[model samples]
Target: MSEPTPLQTLFDTLPQSGSVEWIGIRPARGEAMKALNNVMISRGTGLEGDRFKGRETSKRQVTLIQKEHLYVIAACLHREAISPDVFRRNIVVSGLNLLALKGKTFRIGGVVLEYTGLCHPCSKMETTLGPGGYNATRGHGGITARVVEGGELALGDNVQACS
Candidate 1:
């Protein structure tokens, strides 16, 4: 029998780009909040809110990931403000599964990041992108993370995931 791979080591060890693409952030329902150096507030939910075990509160926090998860290549063509259906993450990442980044710790430009949980889609997506927004691709929009060690993050930043 082979030993299972550690959850912390899910992604390949290759130094890849698009692991941390910083897309433009806009207001979805309220006034545009200032992007703080260590705190950029974002919102998300789980599939049917099940990820939260039926909690009604929408998950909102700062998002983060490893350098390999940025997905800059994709962001350049699609742009950060593109339709919500696509992985239009305010910060499009690559290596790590944004949905599965929960509870993990990573680093971005020397700042420590703490993975929270999956960022499931919500009604706004359906309303904005139509029923197609409810498709499998849009099921869980992505995941959310908090900047434990806040710092200045910009496009093309090299993020590092630490266990």
Candidate 2:
């Protein structure tokens, strides 16, 4: 095999580490998210209790958002603050640029995950976050991921790129 190009090397090197700030699971579609300190991540099934029932190869087994983006979205909507649950993502991570994880596999505590695609804001944002909510979350919607290895993940668990 040939050596990796400069860009590949750059993408592979992620020195910054992040931590899980919050975890949420929805028992069913359109239901309110239930926050938790920790939960079991299962291969093929995603979060143990999440409404998601995708196959093992499904790209959107789990959804995540950056904690910092919440502030940006709030500011865009002229709000004092925004809660993570309103985004309907499964995880809220901080201290890392989640975009950097695109096409990469990372670990959350003992669980490993591979980035799949961007988690775009849905129409529900308009009603849940008020007017202009959809536009406010346009680029801040974060990414979707599929489980690579299953294990326990908890609030405050270290999140880092896989070597």
Task: State candidate 2's TM-score.
Answer: 0.96
lDDT tens readout by residue for model 1, 128-162 = 44455444334345667654554555555565557
Query: Which residue ranges in model 1 land beyond 4 Å of their true spot?
Result: 1-18, 27-59, 64-88, 137-140
140 Cα displacement, candidate 1 (Å): 4.2
After superposition, which runs of candidate 2 have C-alpha atoms over 4 Å from their true positions? none
Report model 1's TM-score to 2 decimal places. Answer: 0.55
Ten-residue stretch with the least lDDT total in model 1: 45-54
